[model samples]
Target: MLTKTEVVIGMTFLVLALLAISVLAVLASTCLVYPIAIDYFGIDQLTGLSRGELIKNYSVLMAYLTRPWVNDLVMPYFRASREGLIHFAEVRRLLLFSQLVAISCLAFTGFWLKRLQGLGQLHHLKRWLLNTCAILLAFCGLIACDFSRAFILFHRLFFQNNYWIFDPRFDPVILALPQGFFAWCAGLAVFYLLGQLILLYIFSIYKEGQAL
Candidate 1:
């Protein structure tokens, strides 16, 4: 009963859903591991010490603190380390909650795509969905590249001598700019995608009436 164009659109939606789910998993893992690794490795304490002291005795601290290994390996360890611990439990709870929200969003989007496919309206889906997806993928890729640069820039601006810890006021403002920009872009993309889906639904209804 489905046409070739509808089938292609459905397949594309399914693929995008799968890819978004995978990205959610990766982000969740990263969020879980980063803090734990910082604590376990004592990166903050190490970095807090004078360079002379680090050079003289804790040379390994430089490698441990500055290396990409913390981002990749240590973060997950930090996430697992908090289990059964009373201290910093609130932070862990919040992290888990945040991850849940992100995963839930991805899951819901995937469900919507599935619903659209089931409605057999793929062929007439708005052009905006494809454009939005493409833009989102590109935006994410750009942010990934920018992340490293931002880290270095922040370090140079604020952390060259001081150990960067959570400062509620400045930290939130500094973090908000990049996150807010990305969120706005992603929101627009999702809006466009949803609009396309709506158009597809209308087209399907029109076609059905014509056949009747």
Candidate 2:
């Protein structure tokens, strides 16, 4: 048996878990879609570098982003200014924060699920879950509709400095990473996240069916 307060807490954790899962899915999709984006966008010709070089450099960047306590990050073919390096370091912090939130919320959700199942109250949470997904999907739709604006807004909100506005002279890596690639990443991330939410929604519905 669960108390009303426990139910409230569990539902809150469930929502946080869903949100964190969506964020992680987006980041994973962005990383996974690099090869496809490179081929699709003719990044090699754009950067005047071979595909192999591009891949190697990008791999280094990704590794640096995921790693902690890095003194300096370097690109084989491009020189990064202090501003560029600082921006990337900020991005790494954001990624680390998201990972922590997702892991913590997921652990709590696992515990909550067992309690809900024991009480046969899984279906009771489906409405809130569906509502949360709907809200997220709506926000994604808005961002997709005006991604250029959203992109700028996202930077302004997250970053206090303007280092994201890269100068090709100092940061040639920006040539390899075009705005179009980021737009594609956002689209793909939304697609992947939607799929996850759909599965979760369906599972909630199944629980509802079982309860009845």
lDDT of 2 by residue, 1-212 (tens): 77889878877876667666766776666656777888999999889999789888987887777666655688788889999999999988887787788789889988887777667877766766677678878998898789899999999999999999999899889999988988876776566666766777687678767778
- Local distance difference test scores for all models: 0.43, 0.80
Instruction: Encode model 1's per-residue lDDT on 1-212: one tens digit a residue.
Output: 55677556655554455444443443434333434434545544644533233233222322233333432222211222222122123323433454455466557655655565567644444444465557756765675667556545644663333333333243321221233333433444444445544555576566546645
Question: How many residue pairs collide in each prediction?
Answer: 4, 0
TM-score of 2: 0.86
Measured with C-alpha atoms, the lDDT of residue 161 in candidate 2 is: 93
* Each prediction's RMSD to truth: 13.9, 2.6
Q: How many angstroms is residue 74 displaced in model 2 relative to the true structure, after the best TM-score fit?
A: 1.5
Cα lDDT for residue 174, model 1?
21
RMSD, model 2, all Cα superposed? 2.6
